[model samples]
Target: MSEQAAPLRRERRTFALGLLAGVFGLLLVPTCTSCGGADESQAETRPLVLSTIGQIHDIASTLAGDDLRTEVLLGAGLDPHTHRPTRADAARLTAADLVLENGLHLEALLHATLDARRASARPVVAVGESIPAEQRLAVGGAGALADDPHLWMDPVLWAEVARAVARELSDLAPAAAPDIARRLEGVLAELAELDAYARRSIDSIPAERRLLVTAHDAFGYFGRRYGIEVASVQGISTESEASVRHVQELVNLLVEREVPAIFVESSVSVRGPRALVEGAAARGHQVVVAGELYSDSMGPPGTYRGTYVGMLDHNITLITRALGGDAPAAGLRDRL
Candidate 1:
């Protein structure tokens, strides 16, 4: 088999096994009458919408408004790529009226749990997969060519995700469809502005210095959307390890291009990024770890950076400033 095809096959096999295990795991959970089915009191008060990531949770909450209750299973700094569903998570999945995940294997470990939930005739939506296949970027460069799951990095693409969430909310609560649509419109406008800001800010960077180096390839969509070149020490998924050769290659790039900053992801280990900095220093090229970027996860909950827009704003503003571009220290809404 070809080298590229080998990893792809392995990933598919792993995903299949995960799904099967999820199914059997769910079967082992002692069935509670209330757990197996939705609670009557909760449904009447507000239908629950559970999401795998905070980005989707924020979108659902915005569109649902007072009509539904929204919660995210993954919190700040949690890596969904490596996150396996606990027994408590399984129960929460079972109890939730609806489930939303980024899909496209972004939730690599949660696939089985999600599939198990879907098999039970429960409502589960992979919102990221809603994006048309052509619009999605293939995982390129020496690895299996799969769809990149970090669509939330691009505001324009994430707007489509918001629309999908709104549709789901509408179908879940037809009575509140109009209200959901209104909220979606506002969210869309805000995203459009964010997209503009990203473009303008990124464009301000000198052409040669517009390279974005990070711990992983999560920023592919962001680079494609804003015309910046992205290079990383790891592949699309955080599950993959950064090889010594890969780190040396990136360090070479940093030294060659004289790139100013490399970033660490909040959800990923700093070891890989730190390695890059150290590698560059050994070659007599100084590079700084600019700041932590929200990759697989967003900021802490109950803060502006915790929200989807805020997450992108933080990334865009941080990247721009670190690369010698101009941006407000407080970010687009002065909330950085």
Candidate 2:
């Protein structure tokens, strides 16, 4: 084989080896099948097993309707930039018929990790890969995530990602394509409404107060979509810490601009941001922690912001309201 062809063949070879192992051994014996529930609860109409990020898992679960059997490797509050898969995640990779990688380097470390598993005939579908070029944005500065991976920030792009995921899962289990597509369409419609509502809500906020300083640069995509000035104390990865100079600079900005409130993230460490708030206070400028926003992970199940749509809607409300704009609770579904 040629140079490029060599690795391709090896990838196929590894996958074939895994396929044989699944065929011969009892590894696929479904030990964690029920997830502590009955058989029906355990397996959906098509038990679309997934090993990827949680955002995709949440969207897939909602779209698939049934159990869907999603095992998130990089879980809530776990940063994928620094995630090193353990043996447990390896088992999930092997069992998954469809490995739904986020595609964008969001799960930068995970692509190679799951590729190593090479699930039998299972496809490691990069759902974000199918995202259209127009909707995509560039990651800030020189780095691996130079092409922004956090596309879930934009609901339109997120809808595309969700559709691709649903389609890939459908192909893996064609019997459920119709069901998956139907649920996905409903979700996209809801997302469109959410986007419109967000536009109207944030539009009311003064441009001067549109500055959003987050815990990290994860909101690049969100900021771009909403015309907000976005800055983060840390870089793209939470593993990357803020430099002394960077922290000092942000404090000075807070003091000079009198930026009232800064937002914290659910998944990232708050220690860095706490220092910023305290630093601002020492300078006689009080910066409020407006609210905790869902960044890499969504809220717990059954809440308003658990899914991708609800997550952003909740964020829009918190940011707009905190920043002197208005987004009523009833705007989404119920009274605010």
User: Top model by TM-score, which number?
Assistant: 1
> How well does each candidate superpose onto the true structure, as a TM-score?
0.86, 0.80
Error of 2 at 30 (Å): 20
Model 2 scores what on Cα lDDT?
0.77
Best by lDDT: 1
**208-286 per-residue lDDT for model 1 (tens digits):** 8999998889999999999999998888988789889989999998899889998998988889989999999999999
| lDDT (C-alpha, whole model) for all candidates | 0.92, 0.77
| Model 2 per-residue lDDT tens digits across residues 1-336 | 579999999999999999999876665455545444576664455464674777788777777676355656666667777778777877777767667877667777776666675534556877877877666776656564356678888887788787887777787667777888888888888879978887888788887878888898888877877888888888887778898889888888878877788999988888878888999999999999998988877777556676666788788888888888877855466522
Worst 10 residues of 2 by lDDT: 27-36
What TM-score number comes out for model 2? 0.80
Which stretches of candidate 2 lie above 4 Å from their native place? 1-45, 67-69, 119-121, 140-145, 329-331
Clash pairs (backbone) in predicted model 1: none
